[model samples]
Target: MSYSTLSSRTVLVTGATSGIGQETARQLAERGATVLLHGRTAEEARAAADRLIATTDVEPRQLHTYSADFAHLDKVETLARQVAAEHPHLDVLVNNAGIAAPERHTVTADGNEVAFQVNFLAHYLLTCLLEPALTSDPGGRVVNVSSALHRTGSIQWSDPNRTRRYTRVAAYAQSQLALTVFAADQRVTAVSVHPGVCDTALLPLYAHKGISPAEGAANVVRLCDPAVEIVNGAYYDRATRVEPAQAATEDRTVKRLNKLADLLVSRSAA
Candidate 1:
């Protein structure tokens, strides 16, 4: 699919150092979009950017790199600020950075579960901060890289942060669920996507069963296409729109999650 509309647009893809995110950046650049490839560190980001420029036919000037550790909310804030300052307008924001179920439960310096922060909250805060840039254009889109596993998740209101007890699967599900709900609640053209279990490092054991990173990225690139009109707040399974878990569709739940997310980000900034 040719995304001629993307020519001259600015896009930011988190987790572009590898997997679906990297492929998504490459494909977008091929469509003539200026891509901001994000990684956890400057070296990682630069390396990824260089590889894209060298391997793809896209011009070197079309690719840029930015780095921030999502585990620390403060760093996420810094990333948002830097992007806003550097780019006058952001046409697309791909919240593709994520971690799968970890073998052991871990907490970040921000006092939140690692999966929750990295997979959901960081993108939430980043999108909030970048709203101005996104809305500056008429067709601004925020494509959140979510998962079909979100159907298995329910918010643990009692322990949303997983401070008391934690399981890798539960934490991962909850984070993705929150992300879907946030997409639903956002006023902008935001939508969540399930890349259909790509073979990424996030799930090494399941690598044999899932599709290739390029296939997963195709679905994401489709959503970013300016010609496609997105059903605001909907969850997509590749090219098809599918229903998420019942909890993800509840208005009360979406509101609650948004409130909690705001509080978390505000606290981290403080």
Candidate 2:
């Protein structure tokens, strides 16, 4: 299903200050898409955008910077509002912001496990808030940069935070699983991709060495193209579509996760 070139599209990529997110923004901007670069702080966001212009042929007009600490839900809400207000017709949302679960179990001020909030919940809230802009156009969609490790996760319904039994790996996996399942949501056209084990800060979780962030970002940028038709809820390992963990595609699990996320995000906002 061929559509249009990115030259006419506007995309917002979270976590663009570094790693895959930064590379994704760079690639998209190079292809003529208006890329919004989000970072943990305003200074970081501006710095990433500056570095892109300095090192690449990308023009300053092609980039915009935004910042919000995902550790806080209110900040996520604010970020969404600013983007939606500034760009009414967002063509793509790359939910690429994430962090490895710290060795010591840590909870955000929002009351969610740090990794879970930063990796999944914040994206969930941002996506929901941006629904209007996403659906304003016919081809708009979401690309979730999930992980293969999601297969190792299970949602602890009784205690989502795993406050009783916290392990860094488990906590991180659960967040990725929730993100993968979220693609099944009927509210929007969305897909998740495990962009291979990239040599980013999170690489230690997968291997001693991995591919470059630009290589992984290519897989993500491909999905953003309207020409590369996608099935809603599809999961991809790099550029090949594949089944996600069984639970990720289950309708019951999707609904359950939505409920859990709604509660978690609303509670934090309240």
Candidate 3:
């Protein structure tokens, strides 16, 4: 894509403290977009921005740092409000923040599985809260950094947190499945992507070795480009657009996931 194509565009990338999220922020900044770098903490966000400025031609003005702990729905709400108030005309939202499920069952203080809440629930709440700002412009869109493992997953509608039975891989895959299903929501122009098994903190969940985060990030950045026309709910494996798991593309699943997410976040469907 042309470097100038992203000029004046404002993109928010969550979990930008390291790995693919950080690299996505770096690449977007290099492409001349105003990048809002989000981290689990303020310090991490600032550090990511510092590293980007020091290593690349990105200037401080081209980066903004934001932080919120996704394990808490309240923090996610606060983050949405902050971003919307400061940058009311956001161009893209890259939901790249995620975590691997623990070997043992665990739940956040919000009473949900750790990985599910951090990976999907938080993004759901953030996206809904930012709908006004996202819809302010015609081409505004959301890119969900989902995973290939979603195909191995199924949502336990009755026990989303897997309170009855839980395994780390199953928990993580379920989160990714929910994220992919969420892209089908008609509330925003959105798509989901499996950026390949990149060498990141979550790599242990996939394999021992993998591609670089920068390589994985390029695939994500491509979808964020306004020059690239995309159909809402499209799913890509790396750069190739392919059909997602059958349930992910179903309208019933989309609505069902949205309803579940709304109840989990303790908010009405937006």
Between candidates 1 and 2, the one scoring higher on lDDT is 2
Candidate 1 lDDT, tens digit per residue, 1-270? Answer: 545657877899999999999999999998889999999999999999899878878898998899999999999999999999999689999999998757787888988888899999899999988888885466688999998778888778778888777778888888988888888875678899998888888665334678889999999999988788788888899989988778878888887887788777774432
Better of 1 and 3 by TM-score: 3
Each prediction's number of clashing residue pairs = 0, 0, 0
Per residue, candidate 3 scores C-alpha lDDT tens digits across 149-169 of 999999999999999999999
lDDT of 2 by residue, 1-270 (tens): 222458998999999999999999998988889999999999999999999999999989999999999999999999999999999889999999999999998999989999999999999999999999995466689999999999999999989988999999999999999999999999989999999899999999999999999999999999999778789999999989999999998999998899899999983422
C-alpha RMSD in Å of predicted model 3 compared with the true structure: 1.1
- Ranked by TM-score, top first: 3, 2, 1
**How far out, in Å, is residue 191 in model 2?**
0.3
TM-score for each predicted model, relative to the true structure: 0.95, 0.96, 0.98
**Stretches of candidate 3 above 4 Å error?**
1-4, 136-138
- Spell out the clash pairs found in candidate 3: none
lDDT of 3 at 78: 91
Each model's RMSD to truth, in Å? 2.0, 2.1, 1.1
Looking at model 2, the pairs that clash are none
Off by over 4 Å in 2: 1-4, 267-270
Give the TM-score (vs. native) of candidate 3. Answer: 0.98
